[model samples]
Target: MGIKIGCCGFPVSRKKYYGEFNVVELQNTFYDLPSIDWAENLRSEAPGDFEFTIKAWQVITHPASSPTWKKMRRKPRGDTSNYGFLKPSNENLEALRETVRVAEALKSKIIVLQTPPSLPYSRESVEWVREFFSKASDIAQGFILGWEPRGEWSKARELYDIIEEFGIVHIVDPFRATPHLGKGGVVYFRLHGIGGSEVNYRYKYTDDDLKRLHEIVSKYSVDREVYVLFNNVYMFDDAARFKRLINS
Candidate 1:
């Protein structure tokens, strides 16, 4: 068991980032799905042992009203509410297929599907997720499906049961909540800062915070691979510091 520390995005140049860390959770894929050629080029440029985990395209989970849509090359047209939210629509399914293609091109081991806070905990939501994953599982084969459910879905036991049923890894912010879906051999932790009602991206971690994180990693990394990804203001520095702490 070992710990892999990285940031949500490349905070430094690719060469410098690869020199420091062996893993990165690509954020670009979440906002916009890149061409397979572009993804392959990135994969070829990196070291063979380097690990790439991509965030699934927004169209797989977010509705068109999401501000993130503005960043996408093709914005949804009228009645965009049904475009996403895992509604099993053709557009969303096509978007997910594209996302899977990109991940395959990059040789990504994990594809993270982060649902928006608006997708609350409910029987309908759970059923939607189950249906979506049932279809998505066929296309996203050969990769671990990681899910980061926001809002009330984070606390719902039914959600965890569904996750376990599909063998999905729970992506979580350890400071916010312990993951309920504990089926996989990988423990993915996304650190988005602490001491706020929501994610505090402005916060910077201290040595004590790093030490606490180290303790958590040590406990979990004894058998499983623990991925600690920083998603805060000082992500690069914080991740580096955490790497050094864990190594020490």
Candidate 2:
């Protein structure tokens, strides 16, 4: 298939996955920003040859309005509404920009905004996302913006259109197969596994499934760049599997 396949992170440390793939999705950004010094500490820990595609912190998208968020809120009793725990807003937009700046400083390839499962496929949310990306794109000039919708809403063309319209990429997690097939800038995937409520959504990629994936990649593998990320963190066993598939 002559494609670049990788995983979310280097199983335990960046040193382990180096030379395995050119890219790794540093997903910690999806949690919360630890500390400027600590973030830099992580950056220093990683090897120089690797490129990182980080996920946006959940705080910006899934703010602290709820009891759960209220506890995780960066600032206690801090106008949770501004950050968009319940929904996106100006404050949330600002937060997204700042995080993008941090990713930029780290020289990350892209920033992924994975919408929480609680988020429904609402027009308002879609519009809000569109507008936010319009603004985020400007700030993240060199880097791409990627979004992965969870659950059933993952397959909605309307949502896909929104992302495509903004020239943003899609993060295709195996847990939510949405049929995106990487139509956007760069097709991204996370191999969760093959069992659970969303088990059907999770693809184990057997030899047959690998053939289908290979065919899909072959069709678009030329010229355009693509990333296949394995989220099945059996200590980077999924990454090793991807390597064999592409090389074979």
Question: Which numbered prediction scores highest in lDDT against the true structure?
Answer: 1
Off by over 4 Å in 1: 76-79
User: Model 2: which ten-residue window has the lowest total lDDT?
Assistant: 174-183
State residue 21's C-alpha deviation in candidate 1, in Å: 0.5
Candidate No. with top TM-score: 1
Q: Return the TM-score for candidate 2, rounded to 2 decimals.
A: 0.80
Query: What would the per-residue lDDT of candidate 1 be over residues 191-220, giving only the tens digit for each residue?
Result: 999988658999999999888878777888
For candidate 2, write residues 1-248 as lDDT tens digits: 23567777667656667756677887666655545666676677667766778877667667564444544436523465566522446667667776776786677877877766666567767676667777777777877877776664566657667665777676664334633533444666666666765434334556666666667666656756667777653626656765787787
After superposition, the stretches of candidate 2 with alpha carbons farther than 4 Å from their true spots are 65-77, 85-88, 174-184, 199-208, 233-235
TM-score, predicted candidate 1 vs. hidden true structure: 0.95
Q: Give the 10-residue window scoring lowest on summed lDDT in candidate 1.
A: 74-83
- Against the reference, the lDDT scores of all candidates come to 0.85, 0.64
